[model samples]
Structure formats: structure tokens, C-alpha cells
Target chain A: MTPRLFQRTASAVLVVLITVSVLFPLAWMAIAGFKGRNEVLRSPFQFFPDMWRFDNYVDIARDPEFTRAMGVTFAGALIFTALSLVVNSLAAYAFARLEFRGKRFWWVYCVMPMFIPMMAILLTSFMVVTKLGMLNTMAVLIIPGVASGAQMFFIRQFYLGFPVAVEEAAMIDGASRWQIFLKLFLPQSAAPFVVMGIASYLAFWNAYVWPILTITDPNLTQIMQFLGTFRSARGNDWGMLMAGSTLASLPTILLLLVFQRFIVNGVRISGIK
Target chain B: MALTPTLAPGPQTADAGRSARGRRGRVKTPPHRRDNRTAYLMIAPMVILLGIFVMWPLVYSVYLSTYEINFYRGSTFVGLQFYRYVLESPDFWHSIVVGLYYSALTVPAMIIIALLLASFIKTLSRRAAAFMKTTVYLPTVVSTVVASVLFVLIYQDEGVANWLLSLISFGPVNWLNDPQLALPAIAVPGIWLGFGLTTLILLAALLDIPESYYEQAALDGAGFFARLWYVTLPLLKNVLLYLFVTGFTLAIQMIDLPLIMTNGGPSEATNTPNLYIFNTFRDVTPYATSYSLTASLLLFVVIGAISAVVFRLVRSDKAIDG
Candidate 1:
């Protein structure tokens, strides 16, 4: 066999192996959600369910805890995304376009948080919110994270790439600075906003540690937090848990399918969370 | 004289077309003054939020770490004592070791796997590569909560993992329930959840390499391995170091899996430093709060030191590259 052919075959095998390793567990989760309780835990586990069950999903849909958590999480994440887009872009636009005193110092100040380990702040943030009597409130969950150093950095990079001529043309049209930002820059920055918005939304959806620390009220529980405690409370209900996880993951999966490049581009622009 | 407005452009565009009506310039403040006011106003929300939540908390934690607080009796100052206590605690040290162990397991392994996968995918057709990339990256979008539950189910005695083991005549292994096997068990999902991002990042780096370099290496009688060793690895040094520092920092704070699956489990084997400190906070005693705060500060120092070392490494590399 030629060396090139051998190399090609090896690459193919690696791709196949990785693809299976990734997809198999996801497949298992989706498939197991349809299995009965007995089938899920049965010895010498059957690869496929004997009889498919929609009851797990149906029961989950009707579960008040599940539905309420979903609603609260959706609303909280939406508020966070909107506020983050505005706050991050406002600062990013200034950094990219405007000249101010202490510009360098402020930029450094904004980016410094990204360098700090999140755990170091976790305890203190809880303490601060507790001291302020905001504990167990969605405000605590959403407001504290609205100003992100990474988002500003990513958005600022996007803004820096904008053609100066566009801004010049807008300025020449008798637009105030605010009008230029709101009317022109915001509309033109749709791509970055969408990417950052999706990223922020998904992040808030997946947030566990903060919600776990701040919220003890079950009624205020976010989806991830609810799913976690639900797992422990509903122990041995593998079917229900799988169904819960599937329900939780659906939005992100749908978002990924629709906006693969935006998600990928978001990662490329900002390394990782 | 036709009065022209001298439009003061930004410093970045200092060379812009400067012919304008100088007469209108008399009526306005300098352009930078207008900019300074608007910029400050625009950035006010972020600055205020970060200052209150992030920066203030950092300082407050330091203050909290120094004192022994009792709500009924008021707070008492014991400077450096809590720090000493945290530094001396065997459990604290053990948790640090556990965090390091988790990092050791996941960081290098993820980098190596990602590098290899990136290289392999580089060999594939673009369409096939995109399919594989998306498939691998799919899990990244799945939250840790969901991933943990999935793995918990998979690692069960009667689950697919044991069934696969039985194919080789091995018995069922206690994965998360066993103290010895627990951290490593958790690391498997960590790798799965993270490697895709690293692969995609590395693949982008790999794709950026000029193909002419490879063709030139081939002309010099370089085999596949020779070319890869001489040509590829050096170019990838910066990206690898970046992944190293960030990934290590990320792995050291491993809490979500342990929180959900093991709850720092069997013998407290999977308890990372952050998890240990969190549990300490839950103790709710004055000493516990101070100890946890001090320990968290120490964790910050460890991460800071790691970052500093990477920065030095990068600086030295830039010098050598130059």
C-alpha cells in the first residue's frame, strides 16, 4: 500500500472514531428518553428500546417545576442578552471609535476581569448580593453578569474592523453621536450582536454555579439548577432525567443548527468562557 | 475670507481630508471634548456594574478574609491568621492536589487529542471535515448539568460502559461511586465537552499555515512525519501555549461535574479546591467563612502564577522568533 493511501485511511478512522465518541452519548440520551424505566436499567442493556415511550417527555411537559423553570430561565436569559449587548457594545464602541482621557487605563480595567479566576469572585459575589438583599432574585442572577470583559473585548474587535467611511458618512449627515451609534452602528453591527446575543443567552441558560449559590427559592430556580436538584430528588428515574435533559438541550441544539457559523465565529472571536 | 470649518478628525485618522470651514470650528468645543463626554457616558453602565460587583468584591473578600466575624458579637480582626489556617490545613492542601490532578488528566490530554484531531481533519475533504467538526463541537453547546446526568447514566453498572467492558470479559467497574476511580471518571466527560473547542481552534491555526511551506519541505526530501515535526509544531507554539494556560485554569475550577454527579463524593476524591472552598462556606461558621475566603484568594494566586509563567514563556518565544 502507498504511504499516502495509508495516511488517508488512518485519517478516516480517526474522524470516524471521534465522531462516534461524540455522537454516541447524545444518541443514547435521545434514545433512552424514549425507553421505559425497566428497559433503561435492565441487565445486558438492549441497544434499542423494546417499546418506545413518549410518556417521559409528555410527563415532563406537564410538570409545573419543569415548565416554570423553563419560563424563568428563558426570561432571565433574554434580559441578560439584551442588556449585555447594549452594555458591551456601548463600551466597545467608545473604545473602538471615540477618544477619551484615560482611554488605555479604562480599557485595561475592563479587560482585567477576564484574567481573574471566576471562582475567586464566586464567593464574594454571593456575599455582595446577600449583603444587598438581592439574593434569590433574578436581578442578582442577571445584573451582576451584564458587564462582561470578554464580550466587550470581542465586540470591540468587531467594531475596530468597521470602515471609517461609514462613520464619516453618518457624521456628515448631521447625526449626533448617539444617533450615529443607535441608528447607524447598531443596525450595521447586527452580526456581532446576534453572535454575542446567542452566546450570552446560551451561557445564561447553562449557568449552574451562580444560580446554585444565589437562589435557594425553588420558585426562582433556573432550568439548569432545577434540572440538577430534580435529578437528586427524582433519583432512579433515569427516563425522566433523560427526558428533562433533552428538553433542556433542545433550544441550544436548535440554535446551533440554525446559526452554526455565528456560534463558531463567536468562539473564534472570543477564545472560550 | 471664506471662513472654513476645520473638522477635527480623530487621532487614528489624522491624515484625513483636512479642508473644511474654519469659521464653524469657533462655535464648537474641541472634537475630543465631545468624544470624552460621550465615551464616559456610554461606558458608565459597564464601569459601574464591574466596579460594584467584580472589583469591589475582590477587595471586600480580602477584608473578609482577614477578620473573624460573629454577627451577634460584631466582627474581630485577626490579621493573617485565617490565611495561616488555610495554608496549614491538610484538607486544603489535598484539595489543591486534587485540582492539580484533574488538570493534569484533562489539559495535556485535551491538547494532544485536539492537535491530533485537527491534523487528521486537515487531511479530509472540506465537506467531511465540516461534518466532523460540527459533530464534535455539538457537545460543547450541551450544558455541564445535562452532560453530567448523561454520563451518570452511562457509567451505571448495567449501563453501556459496563456492557462494553463485558465484551472483553472484564467486570463492571464502580466509576463515580469509587473514590479511586471517581476523579478520572469525571475527567472523561470534561475532555469530551472541551476537546471540540480546542480542535476547532487548532484546526483554524492549522488551516492558516501556508501550503507552500509543506511543498518546500517535500522538495527537501521530507517525509510526512519529518515535515510535520520540522514545519508544523513550531508554527503552532503560540496557540498551544494559549490553550495550555486557559485550559489549565478552566480545569482547575472543575466544580459542575463534581457538584452534580459525585457531590465531591465517596471519599471526597473529586473535591477540587473551588468545590472544597464552596463546601467550607456552607459550613457557615466565622472561621469557615474566613478560611474559605482565604483559600479562594490562594486559589487566585495559583491561577495568577500559572498565567504569569505562560506570559513569560510567550515573551521569550517572541524574542526567539524575532
Candidate 2:
């Protein structure tokens, strides 16, 4: 074979290998969710289930704690997303457009949290939240993350790229600073807002450690918290675990499918993680 | 018309905005003058939240590390005793070693795999590349805990993994149950769920390379491997460096996988420092809180040092220029 033909064959094989390795686990999870309890742990494992058990999902649906956890997690994520969008974008606008005393100083001060890894402060932040009597409350989940240096920085960069002509045009129309920001700048920033919104929502939804520390009440448990605890308690029940994990991953998966463009952009822009 | 003098472009804003200032003819202040009150109001929420929660806690962690907490009586100032104790503890050192081990397993492997997959994918048809990219990235949206649960099933003795080995005429292996195999077993899922994003990022970098570089190399009779080594890799140096530093730091701090999969078990082979600190916090004792805090700070300092050394070693002024 020619060198080019060999290379093409190798590329094809690698592509198939990469795709299967990447997806086979997820496909297993989805398939296993439909298997009967005995079938999941059956020796010389069967790739396909004898009977597709929809009752696994039915069990999840009948679970009040699971439903409540889903509600609480979704509500908290939405609220957090809204709050971070407002708070971070406001700060981003100020950093991008407004000039003030100690601009450099305060900018550094606001974005300083980026320098400290969250794990380093996790213990003390838990203590602080506990001291404020916010443990087991949704406020603990939402409040601490509302002010994000990374989001502020990202939005600031986006805003800086905006043409200055629009703002000047708005100013000539006798708009106040508030009017220009509220009416002009904010609307024009829909793309970054969508990016930040999806990012914040996903962060809140996918959070594990902090939720475990702060929320012990089953009703207040986040989805990941619920899944983690459930996985341990029901260690032998592979069917239930797969069902719950599928349910847990559904929203984010759906979001990715629907908002592929924005999510990919967000990942590209915030590539550190 | 630039009624808001703050809209001017530079430190020397008066001259730049003079055209608009003259058009508006309503300038009553210096061109560089800013609306301090508006800026202050705009930034108030972030400043206040970050101060009370983020900044204050960082400082307070240092303070908490110095003092020992006693729930029965009260807290007392120990003045770095906890720090010294934690630093000297063999378990603390073991946890650090485990963290380093995990990073060693993850960082380079992920980078190389990602690099190869990305460069290969770059040669595909655009449609095929898009399909590959989407499939690879699909798992990234799954929460870490959920992925761990899926892997827990996959790594079971009677699970798909062992069944696959059976296909190759190998015996079933205890993946998470064996001390020797557990850490590496756990790293499999970490790489599985992780490298997709890295591949996507690297693929983007690969696509950005100018065709002329490859053409230039081919004109000099460079083979595929030579062209890749000389042209492609050098152009991707900054991005690779950035990914390496960030990926290594993140890997060393891994908690979700170990915490869920092994709980740092099989003779504590997978107990990352973050896991050790977490376990200490959960199983509280008189000085557990302070010990955990000190350990956390130490780990942070080590991570800082590692990042700094890598950045220093790769001290290209263009390290993050893209």
C-alpha cells in the first residue's frame, strides 16, 4: 500500500476507536437503565436487555425525594443564573465603559477571587455559610457563587469588543448613563448573556461538593448530591442508579443539544477547566 | 456626540473626544472625568458578595489554620501548631503523593491523546470532523458524579469492561477492588470524561495553523511525522503550555471521581489531598477542621508552586498570546 493509503486506513481505524471509546460508556448507561435488576448484574453480560423495563423510570418518578430534589436543583440553578447575569454583567459594563477613581484597584479587588482556587477556600466558606445560619438553605447554594470573577472577566472582554459608536450615538440622544447601559448595552450583549446564563446554570446544576457539605436535608439536596448519596445507598441496584443518572444528566444533555453553538463557544472561551 | 466624557478612548481622552465634545458643545468638565457614583453602584453587588464570601474566607482560612477549634469548650489560638502537625503527618504526605500520582497519570496522557486525536480529526471532512467533535464532547456535559456512577457499573467484576477482556481471552480483573489497580482504574474515567474537551480545544488550535507552514515543510521533503513534529507542534506551543498548566493543576485537585468511586479506598491508593481534607472535615474531631484547613492551604501552595514552575520553565512571553 502507498503511504497515503496506509495513513487513511489508520485514521479511519483511530476515528472508529475514538468514537466508540468516547460514547460506549454513555450508551451503556442508557441501555442499562432499561434492563431488569437481575439482567444488569448477569454474568457474561448481555448488551441488550431481555425486557425493556420502563419501571426504572417509573420508580424515579414515584420517588418524592427525587422529584423534590429535581425541583430544588432546577429552581436554584435558574435563580443563580439570573442573579449572576445581572451582577457580573453590571460589573463587566462598569469595567469596560466607565472610568472611575481606583478603577484599577477595584477591578483587581473584584476579580481577585480568580486567583484563589475554590478548593482552598471550601472549608472556610462552609464555616462562613454555617455561621450565617444559611446551611440547608437555597441561599447558601446561590449566594456564594453570584459574584464570579471569571464571568465578570469574560463579559468585560466581550463588552470591550463592542463598537464605541453605539454608546456615543445613545449619549447624543440625551440618554443618561443608566439609560444607555440599560437600554442599549444590555440588549446588545445577548450572546454573552446567553453564554454566561448557560454556564452559571450548568455550574449550579452540576455542583457536588459544596452541596453535599451545606445541604443534608433530603428535600433540599441538589441533583448531584441526590445522585451521589443515592449511588452509595443503593450500591447494589444498578438499574436504579442508571435510571437516576440518566434522569440527572437529561437537562444538561438536552441543553447541549439545543444550544450547541452557545455552549461550544462558552467552552472555547473558558477553556481552563 | 460624546456627552459622557468617560466614553473617550484613552488616558489622554480630552484630545481624542474633542471632535465629539465640540459637536455636543455641552462639555462642562474634563474629557477624562468619570461618573464615579454610577460605577460604584454598578459594581456594588459583586464587590460586596466577593468580599464577604470569597475574599474574607481566603483570609479567614489562614486565620482558622493558625487556631485550633474545640467545640466543647471554645476555640483557642494555637499559632501554626496545626500547620506544623499537618505538614509533618505521614498521611498528609501520602495524600500529596497520591495527588501527584494522579496528576502524572492524567496530565500528559490526556495532552498526548488529545493532541493525536485533534490532529487526526483535522484531516477529516468537515462533516466528519463535526460529528467526531460532537460525539467526543457529548460526555463532557454529564456531571462528574453521574459519570462516576456509570463507571462504577462499567468497572464491576461482571461488567462490560471484564466482558471485553473476556473477548480478548483475559480473565476478569477487579478494577476498583484492587489496591494496585484502583487509582489507574479511576484515572480511566477521568481521562474518558476529560480528554474530549481537551481534544476539541487542541483541534481548534490545529485548524488555526496556516496551510503555508505545511506546504513549506512538504517542499523541503518532510514526511508526515516530520511536518507534524516541526511545523504543527511548534505553532501549538502556547496553547499546549496553557492547557498543560491548567490541566495539571486541576488534575492534582481531583475529588469527585475518587470521592464517588473508591472513597479513597483499596488501601487509600486514590486518596487525593482534596479527598483527604474532605474526609477529615466530614469525620470531625477536635482539631479536624483546622487540620483540614491547613492541609488545604498547603495543597494550594503546592499547586501554586507547580503552576509557577511550569509557567517559569515555559517562560515564553507568548505563552497565552492567542
Candidate 3:
């Protein structure tokens, strides 16, 4: 083979190195989760458990705090994702189609919030949630996140590109603005909405800080942060943590599997270009 | 003046124009009711949610930022005192310097590596491209916390990383344990997670370049680096700018890795502004630590200012690009 082929082959090898480096930890963690405590620490080559601890799953499932936190996480993430969809879709339509005063100003302001750090507002957000007596509730958990800057920008960009002829033709009839919007605009904008849905779902699902801030009740803690407490310096069980970690990742992976096309498209179509 | 009337054109032209201009919201005749319904139906959900969640909370945050408001049992009308305190803090200053330092280190590294990787991908066969993309993007899909846990294991004294170094006759560097190595160690996983997507994006940007440009460059006797430096780099200018601006803003807002991996360890060597926010919010409160209103406001001002500068510069570039 030519030097060009050799170069390409070498580059692929480098990628494989990077890929193995990235995936090895995950494989190790998963394997170690099933291993006995001694095997996990003493031996590096033990790829699987000597005695498969299917019991770890049962052990974790029986823990009330674990199950409750998992429930809260699922509920909060799901609700936040739903709220984001509704808010993003509606605002996107207005920005795309409405001829309101200060539309440009509104658009800029809407997108500006997206750039603000969660850290910047995290403190104030925590205060707001507590003040409203919504602390530890999914109300606090899901509500604030609905105002997604990226989602608005995305939907707005997507809608801007969509053909406007359909809506105008609908308007030519006696249909009201609401009728045209619901009947005409939204049906065609499924492409973006689905994209935003997947992105928001994954984001809210993986989020850690906001949930940790707002939730004081163990019962209300999200699974990921709850799993964080297991990272003790001492003799904590790796099996339980890994088992929990594995469970924690399943929903997101499953969701991604179901919406691979849209999720990939969402990331691809994220920018204004 | 004639300019006054022209400047404030009537809505009638817009209404009339809407019918002829586009198709998405178009409807049957009796234009007034049809248009009104179309506007409302399309606009209601997004507006209401944005208002209730985004707008209201935003106003409240600003309001809280003005007052010395704790989560519970304490309140005072401080009149930007929180912002004042935040501006004065030593840690705040440190976070700013460190945040920029981290971004400066990470973004360029990712971009250069991503470009090279993308160049490689463009040369791959179709089957190879698909497999390569999937492998590359896998890290991104994994949760940062889980990755953090995995890394802590790798960086442990008995871990693989140190073990490899020993074999090579180089003394083992305590990666996460040592303050100096902690920042780079913390940054590595993010680069690993980030490189794949950037590679794919630049590859798309690369694919848009016609093969004719390369042939012309070859005919002109420009070497690979010369062709890339002169032709490919210039064409990728806009994409690069986009990457830089977005990359810079995101690096400043980074929370996950520092929060999980180091917990800003080794005497706060890796403490990021975002991690500081969490610490303030969730710290060991003897009697419920005050709401991070002041700290948050400062962060908001800092982040908002940074984003504004980035966006302003990029917008001007966009105008030029257009």
C-alpha cells in the first residue's frame, strides 16, 4: 500500500487508542460492579465476577432511598423535558411567524438566557425554589429548566427555514391565528420539536447540580447525585455503585436508541448555519 | 417628515403581504379570523411557558440579587450588596483567572485535534466512516459523573495510568492527587468526550469543499500544509470562529467535571466558578447557609458579560461572512 494508505491506517489506529481509552473505564466499572471486593482491588485481569452478584441488583432495588430517588429523577427529568418542548415550540412559532413589536429585541433576549451559566443563576434559583416552598418538589426540579435558550434558538432557526406558504394559505381561509398555528404550523414543525425533545430529555436526564441544589430530601434526590454519595473514600461497595450506575444510564441509552435519528439530527442542526 | 411615516409603516401591508409570502400558516378565506386564530394557536403554548418559567424566574432572580435573601429565615434590602460582595471576593477573582486559563488550554487543543481527525475521516471508506463516528461519539453519551468515577480509579495509586508510567521508567505522577496534574487530569475526559463531535462537524465542513480546490492547489505546487494553510484554513474560517466563540462560552460555564472528578480538590486548586456556586448552595450549613443570591448575581454578571462580548464579536464576523 502507498504512504497515503499507511497514514490513514495509522490515523485509524490512533482513533482506536482514543476509543479504547474512553471505553475502558466504563468496561472496568461495569465489570468491577459484579466482582467481589477482593477481586476488584487485587486483580486487574478479572474481567467478570467469580460468583455473579445478581443479588446486588436485588439489594439496590430493595433500598427505599434508592428507588425513591430514582423515581423522583425520572419524574422531574420527564416533566422538565415536556415543559421545555411546549415552551420551545410555542416561542419558536411566535419568533418565526409573529409580526409583534420588538420582535428582534425579544429574540435576542430569549437567546441570551441560553448563554448564562447555570452557576450564575444556580444560587438565585435555589433561593427562589425554597422561597416558594417548592423545595424538594419536582415543581422546583422541572420548572426553571423549561426556559431553554438553545431549544428556543434551535426551534426559531428551524421554523425560519420552513416554508411559510402553508401557514399563509391557511390564513387565506377563515381560520383564526390559533387555528392556523395548531393546524398548519405545528404539524409541519415536527422535525424540530422531535429534535428538541430528544436533546432536552437527555440534558435534563443527566443534569446533576440543579437537582442537588433544590433537593434536600433524600426521597427527592435525583438518581445521579444520589449515586454521588457512594463515592466515599473508605470501604463503600463498588458493586452497588456500579449496579446503580448501570441502572442510572439505561433510561438515557434507551431513549437515545428510540430517537437516534432525531437526537443525532438535533446535535447536527444545533447551530444557525 | 416623509421619513416618519415610512419608518412606521402600517400593519396592513404586513397582513396583505403575509398571504402572498409564505405557506406554513396560510389558511382559507375571510382573512381576519383565520389570521387571528393562526397567530394565537401557534403562539400560545410557547409564550405562556416562557413567561411563566423563564420570564418570571428571571425577574425574580434579579430581584433577589438586589436583596440579601437567604433560602429561608433571612432577608434584607441590600441594594446590590450581593453583587458588591461577589466582586470583592478573592475566590471570585481566582475562579475568573482559572476559568479563562482552562478554556484557553482546552478549546484550541480540541480544534486542532478535531481538524486532523476530520481530515482523516474524509479519506475513509463509507463503512469505516460510520464505525469511526460511532466510536468517537461514545464518550459524549456517557454521563460525566460516571466518567469521573472511572477516572478516579485510573488515577489511583494502584491504577493503570501510574502502572504504565512505571514500566516506561518514568516516575509516576499522582494525577488527581497532585494539585498541578489535577487541572489537566480533570480536563482530559472532557476533551476525550468532545473530540468526536468536533471531528464530525469539521468533517462536514471539510466535505463541503470541492475536490477541484485540492487539485488546483496541487497544480500550483503547494504542499499539503501549504494547501491546508492557504485554502482549507481560509474556507474553514467561519466554522472555526463559530467553534471558538461557542467553545469559549461553554468552557466558562463548565460545571460537571470539576464538581464530580476532583470536587475542586487539593486545597481548592481546581475549584471552578460553577463548583463554587454549588458549594455555596449546598455547603455544610451550621444553620442553613444563606442563599447564594450574591454569588449567583456576580456569576450572572460575569457570564453575561463574557457571552455578550463573544456574541458581539461573532455577530460582526457573521455580517462580514454574509
> For all the models shown, what interface RMSD does each have?
11.5, 9.1, 10.7
TM-score for the A-chain in each candidate structure: 0.91, 0.91, 0.87
lDDT (Cα) of model 1: 0.81
Off by over 4 Å in 2: A1-16, A267-273, B1-32, B316-322
**What's the CA error at residue B42 for candidate 3, in Å?**
4.8
Per-residue lDDT of model 2, residues A112-156, tens digit only: 666576778898898899999999889999999899887887777
**Model 1 steric clash pairs:** B4-B21, B4-B22, B5-B20, B5-B21, B5-B22
TM-score of the A chain in candidate 1: the value is: 0.91
Q: Residue-wise lDDT of candidate 3 within B52-115, one digit each (tens)?
A: 5555556776776676644465777768666666788788778777677778778898899889
For model 2, residues B238-273, the per-residue Cα lDDT tens digits are 677777777777788889999999999989999999
Score chain A of model 3 by TM-score against the reference chain A: 0.87
> How many clashing pairs per prediction, in order?
5, 0, 40
lDDT per residue as tens, model 1, B1-322: 0000011111112112121222234335576545788999999999999998899989988998899978778889999998889889999989989999999999999999888888888888978887877887798889999999899888999988889999999979988899999999999999988888788878877876889999999999999789879888888777777778778878998889888889888888999998999899889575777788899999999888987887687757552130
Candidate 3 off by > 4 Å: A2-15, A43-68, A232-235, A271-273, B1-84, B282-292, B307-322
Global lDDT of model 2: 0.81
| Candidate 3 lDDT over residue span A10-79, tens digit each | 8778768866765776677776677665555543434567887776677778888888877877887677
